[model samples]
Target: MTAIPNETMAIIAGGGHLPQLVLEGARSMGLRVVGVGFAGETDPSLADSMDAWQWQNLGQLGKLIAFCKKQGVSRIVMAGKIHKARAVDLRPDWRAAKLLWKVKNTQDDVLLRAITGELESEGMSVVSAMDFLPHLRSPEGVLTRRGPTSEEQADIDFGWPMARQIGALDIGQCIVVRKRTTVAVEGLEGTDATILRAGELVGPGCVVIKLFKPIQDARLDLPAVGPKTIQTMIEAKASCLALEAARSLFIHLEESLTLADKAGISIVGLRS
Candidate 1:
């Protein structure tokens, strides 16, 4: 969320609201957008908003870069979810294969950093999605009608570092807890699926905690939650949310807070 570019910027889009959000932000700032979306990860309808657009396979790093260079892009903002499990479906071309061969492990941060390095070497800066969607970031404080109850606060205290530990291991960014017992840890199924899985496991009254990984790259991905996340928690009958304040993105803020307030869900923005 620093200074927005006035020249054309690139949206390395994924799915859901990501492309549209960046498009809207870029348009508002008078920056024309050039987009390249991952094949199965991006919405096709978003092609209309791009001054230049293309759909690329997951491992077509060469083609992706070439397309951006062709459109004279200098800055790139990546948004939306790219399921790591999609590695199973990866069809790596020479450039991507070379990059993969140099990596020691396939952890999200490691791979993303490698990709960022690759982009930077080519004179393309990789920026955060939050740069375009700054309003979605939740500030530090209680965000709903109530703060976490003592018992819920206990659960948050208990789960917070555990979430951080898994994050340190680069496992994932979320953990579900109830009365200090771990319910479900996110395993690439995503936060929403993790919440629903926890609800199914323990049934109601669970606390969901999401954090920014200790080793996370601030310029890249920060975990995102939104109105849809609240809707999922409501459906799961989860009681509270303890998200890292000033670190997490709370998209659709008013609607999400309204949903949480109506459902009597305690949403405290946890400061690290």
Candidate 2:
């Protein structure tokens, strides 16, 4: 594939290592990257990795749009996690206020959908987070040194449809199963918390399944996992993690797999 064009690519970041990865990916692909990180959430070190970086609170829609325009950014990608709980303190500008009033639902999809449309209306096209970081996309088949046991495989197969259904409804993108029964579904608390909760509820050998919602907008968000996921699984006594291959982001793949191998946790990236 050709390298990313030498265009101005703006990254609107929130929290987690995902934004940092996105910056690195963009730079490697030959793009001039500018970053807009959220206050108190995004890592400040991200600035060192970008051509230019600025911080803002979660509700500064006007500032974000202005920053992009000033940088001559034609393409934008958003990465990292923004805790919805923090919306309680949101201070929206006129532009953001108008968008908020137009949106009927405050659910993740509704909010992001509105934001996407707002950005597009302002002439800033949102690029997929994986646009330059395709390698972070999960690969098919078993990824860890050890494959899942028969029982774990059975759990994965059993939970696959249910997980996808949950995802389709936007209830969550992850489900924890044990003995073919769901233990926990990931919602706002996120994957790590969900896995820990599942372990507590189901005890040992629970299988975790994570997949992109059937109607998920790849340009905006996708379920993500990393090395910390393996640690959480091991702590919870989980035996396996089945992620939707190529649809989910596999952050920190090398360290994640190393930890999984050491913990005897099976990591499988599956299609469907």
Scored by lDDT, model 2 comes in at 0.87
Per-residue lDDT tens digits of candidate 1, residues 1-272?
A: 44446677888887778669878987787787899887678888888878989988888999988988888887888888887779656888999899999999778889889989988899988887777777778778888889999999999999999999999898899999998999999987889999999999999999999999999998766888888899999999999999998888888888889999999999988788
Per-model TM-score versus the true fold: 0.95, 0.94
Once superposed on the true structure, which residue ranges of model 1 sit more than 4 Å away at CA? 1-6
Cα lDDT, all candidates: 0.87, 0.87
Off by over 4 Å in 2: 1-6
Q: Please give the RMSD to the true structure for each candidate, in Å.
A: 1.5, 1.7
Question: What TM-score number comes out for model 1?
Answer: 0.95
Q: Per model, how many backbone clashes are there?
A: 0, 0
